[model samples]
Target: MSALDHIRKLHLPDGARILDVGGGSSVLVDALLRENTSWSITVLDISQSALDHAQTRLGSLAKRVTWVAADITQWIANDPVDLWHDRALLHFLADASDRATYANTLRTALKPGGIALIASFSLNGPEKCSNLPVHRYDAQGMLATLGSGIILKDHWLMHHHTPSDKVQEFQFCLFQRV
Candidate 1:
């Protein structure tokens, strides 16, 4: 199953707080809103324009979401969330310090026993995306980079076909905060 499908199957409780890191204009929000389960969703992205596009697409449903325009490495979550989701964001953190800051932010934002679903470029994936270099990882490497507070529960590789029909390998890891 795709990472998004796996997250959908999680069946988190109603009113569960969720943070979607770097979830710019992704349709994941739309899909979740269509589900019967009620979630307090927050979409955090560095680009306001992307968030605005999503808002325009969602129309009235956008009102249900909390949108934050800030860098994940710099932004501190005011409260912990039950679920933290990141898709294709971590790989962009090629710098060690930035990745460390990301890990710290993640630790601070996720509550104990919370679930974190992170997807990144796999080992065999492209070295660069959008002309920017990326740090590819397998499941183990991802866990190490994310640090000690979380334990890997499951991981799998998926092939994503871009609009241009280019296939990109991605590793999706599911973790639980200790």
Candidate 2:
């Protein structure tokens, strides 16, 4: 199975609250919702235009998913989340402080044993995406940044097939908050 397909199989519970960080145009949440009617999806992004586009694309499914427009660095949730889904977001946080803040937000919002599925540009991936610099990660580097206490459940190196059929290498790290 594909890396993304494997991520979908991560053993998230039914009726779980999932936070999709930087899930602007990502169809991952849509696919997850389709697979499990009981799951609640919340898509968070810094761009309103992107969120609007996602809503339009989701159509009726949009109502079932919550949309939040905010930078991940300043994100905080009143309720804890069961899963934190972050793909192609953490890599953009090249600054040490920004990455720390992003990590803290996730730590604060996630319940104990909550899962985090994060994907970052791999060492072989493009140097830039969307005209922005990105930080590449090997498995250990990504885990170390998130710190200890979180148990690493699994990891995989895979390539994403873009619209133009270009392939982008990435590392997916799964963790359970302890």
Alpha-carbon lDDT, every model = 0.90, 0.86
Which candidate wins on lDDT? 1
lDDT of 1 by residue, 1-178 (tens): 7545787778788888989998987888887777744788899999999999999999999999999999998898888998999998899999999999998889889999999999999999999977899999999999999898999999999999999999999999999999
**What TM-score would each prediction reach against the true structure?**
0.96, 0.92
Off by over 4 Å in 2: 2-4
| Structural RMSD, model 2 | 1.6
Query: Model 1: which ten-residue window has the lowest total lDDT?
Result: 1-10
Best by TM-score: 1
- In the predicted model 1, the residue pairs found to clash are none
Per-residue lDDT of 65 in model 1: 91
Q: Evaluate residue 52 in candidate 2 and report its C-alpha lDDT on the 0 to 100 scale.
A: 97
User: What TM-score should be assigned to candidate 1?
Assistant: 0.96
lDDT of 2 by residue, 1-178 (tens): 5434765687777888998899988888778778788988899999999999999998988999999999988877878999898889999998989987877888887899999988999989988889899988888888788886677898888888999999999988888899
Displacement of the residue 63 alpha carbon in candidate 1, Å:
0.6
